[model samples]
Target: MDKIKISNLEVFCNHGVFKEENVLGQKFLVSAILYLDTREAGLTDNLEKSIHYGEICKYIENFMKKHTFKLIETAAEKISMNLLLNWDNLEQIDLEIKKPWAPIGIPIENVAVEISRKWHTAYIACGSNIGDKKKHLDDSIYALNQRETCRITKVSDFILTQPYGDVVQDDFLNGCLELKTILNPKELLTCLHEIENAEHRERIVKWGPRTLDLDIIFYDDLILADDDLIIPHIEMHKRDFVLKPLAQIIPYKRNPVNHKMVIEMLYDLQK
Candidate 1:
């Protein structure tokens, strides 16, 4: 959407590889583009409805002076995360960290790192078939809500469903959750795995039975594939347990691979 740009603002901070660089400090120029919806603030002329650029500059200045890091990369990472966490209305950040003074002998203009970071919308499928199935599912949602990088936006009511794979086990309580997350796909997967292990989940017979099963149904519009994880879950549209809940919240979300919306998939499954 809309953006507020903060051009090259100079600040002196101690961030370098050399020992003296940390002691003496150097000049750094930072530029940031803050993304947000300005319609509310614009219409009302309300300061509270918008992010204050003046205050943000002051925050940046203070943070630069307070922390001493060996590399600008580290500083940029922390700053971006902090901005996203602190500014509720901000949707994304485009940041550039420029270092004018360099040890290299060549006369170069500047060395800098530019990066883009944003909160991604993710949908997760959670199920449990073993002991305390509902409890396990609820606990996993609680755990995800506690993380700073993850915010649980919505959760579907648990539904009883038969076990997907061939195994002599009890029916599962399945549900879906929508989240706004700053964590990357891999990082989010790791967090899910951690929650599963905490609930004593097991993977003996390939989705046969478990205390908790968490799967990534969707992450933004991303189409990702790896040995350990896959995005836009490969078979989610084909499973009623998955579509029933997912369609509740994101009925219009389209599958990047198949070019079909959740509503279309749900209708197709029922026929």
Candidate 2:
């Protein structure tokens, strides 16, 4: 990835803990490193193909002036997220804010906060056995799409599937969605739980009936296991419900753990 750097860009904004400081306002030094592919622009020498630094600088100034927060941490977080949300080509950002006029009596050069953030790809499986199954699945998708940090890139058509465990239940509407998120594994799991609970999902019995069920099937080819979560989801390749939808969107996607393509696994399962 190519990089763009903007350093020591000054902005006057009102952000501090003290009431007087907020009212008086202060000068802040902002720096940022934007990560994106610049090969196309380099080859064509076209300004349209790359990020416009001048525009981004003005945007930074406006954004900082538009909002007021007590901590630079919050300011940086909001700025970074907003940049990612508005800019399609930006893949990651490293932002730094320097408070040279901090009210601390102790003599110090400056107080600053720097943070790095990026987007990650994750695949999630959706299932529901009770109530309006299609509505349950649809609502889950809608909720995921509504989250600012998450973007749904693809979705497979819902398929009817028998219950997995021994508990007797009606057929489930199963599907999968390709999600791009800024949240890490644990945070993403938490978001999924929120969506499930919002749809009134119950965990009374193992793999039992529910209004909605959301499971992390994959997280960037990551191989992981813990007391609470597992990745490449245990035995996902063997289950038609999981494999079928996964194959539809990512047939060529390789399982980092199993070392096999999604289509290959689905074919073997079908055979």
Model 1 ranges with Cα > 4 A deviation: none
- How accurate locally, in lDDT, is each candidate? 0.92, 0.93
Candidate 1 residue-wise lDDT, 1-271, digit = tens: 9999998889998888999889999999999999999999999999889999998899888999899998888888888999999999999999899998976779988899888889999999999988888899989999999999999999988999988866888898999999999999999999999999999987779868899999999999999999988898999978989998898888999999999999899999999
> Which parts of model 2 have CA positions greater than 4 angstroms off?
222-227, 235-238, 264-271
- For all predicted structures, in order, the TM-scores are 0.98, 0.88
Against the true structure, candidate 1 reaches a TM-score of 0.98
- Each prediction's RMSD over C-alphas, in Å, is 0.9, 2.4
- Best-matching candidate per lDDT: 2
Candidate 2 weakest ten by summed lDDT: 230-239
| Model 1: pairs clashing at backbone N, Cα or C within 3 Å | none
Candidate 2, residue 79: the lDDT equals: 90
